[model samples]
Target: MAQAITAERGQWYKRLDLDENFEVVAIDRDEECIEIQYYSGEIEEIDEASWELLEIAPIAPPDNWSGAFGSDNRVEFEAQADSLETALNMVDNSN
Candidate 1:
């Protein structure tokens, strides 16, 4: 019997039966299919039926999202700089 849980994009889930963690990357309702990326960088396409067949539980995102990528791929994401007016507006001159 399929579980009541249905896969949704951007959600993390653990497959209890296989002890594997996967993230739902994309869903195509028109195609009735789902794309999942495993912790080991493996991408698999499964139909909705197959998704429900798995014993999965919703889980918090893993501590390290770079499980699939190598050290070379690890890079810090920098915040974009604000506009000149925005930056000037935040200056403190209450001395």
Candidate 2:
């Protein structure tokens, strides 16, 4: 059976079970900091200095990408930009 996120007033934690054998705790936090529990039963407190890592976007290329065109249909590339404005510029400059 899969474990679902059933919110409780004082739960203040999120967990995930993998392979029906091990579990992964995604977020276990209180008022001050967060804690993580691994499958090996090792518990570690996430450092405040590295908290910014959670806010970072995980993407090799951003979603705002403009497709590239070539004389050959099979030869094509994509222009991935950090912002919509930049993606528009990449597509509009083809002319």
Candidate 3:
């Protein structure tokens, strides 16, 4: 199933079509566009159609979970990180 994004300011998203990561800077409901700041520091306005190509960025596991794992489950922690990277790569290659 596809993930749902709230599209709020400061939220990060990965553009599936471009393999680029961007953060939401603003949303113009009247214009139906979202202002995004790319990882490269470029700002652009994307319409609803363009927004459809984006997915919410993967976030790290919660601090409490990490604390529970501590150092004994280093391999499992790495695997989780790798999984997120793979998911992002899949999104990039989808287009």
Give one clash count per candidate, in the order shown: 0, 0, 0
What are the RMSD figures for all models against the true structure? Answer: 11.3, 17.0, 13.6
For each candidate in the order shown, give its overall lDDT on alpha carbons.
Answer: 0.68, 0.32, 0.58
Off by over 4 Å in 2: 1-31, 54-95
Candidate 2 lDDT by residue in tens digits, 1-95:
33223322111132322221111123344543444433344555554343334322112222212221122321232325445444335545755
> In angstroms, how far off is 25's CA in candidate 2?
5.8
Put the candidates in lDDT order, highest first. 1, 3, 2
Candidate 3 clashing pairs, residues 3+ apart or interchain? none
lDDT tens string, model 3, 4-33? 566765456676657776666568999999
Q: Candidate 3: where is the Cα deviation over 4 Å?
A: 1-4, 55-95
The local lDDT score (0 to 100) that residue 19 gets in candidate 3 is 78
Query: In candidate 1, which residue pairs get closer than 3 Å at backbone N, Cα or C atoms, i.e. clash?
Result: none
Q: What TM-scores do the predictions have? A: 0.70, 0.23, 0.49
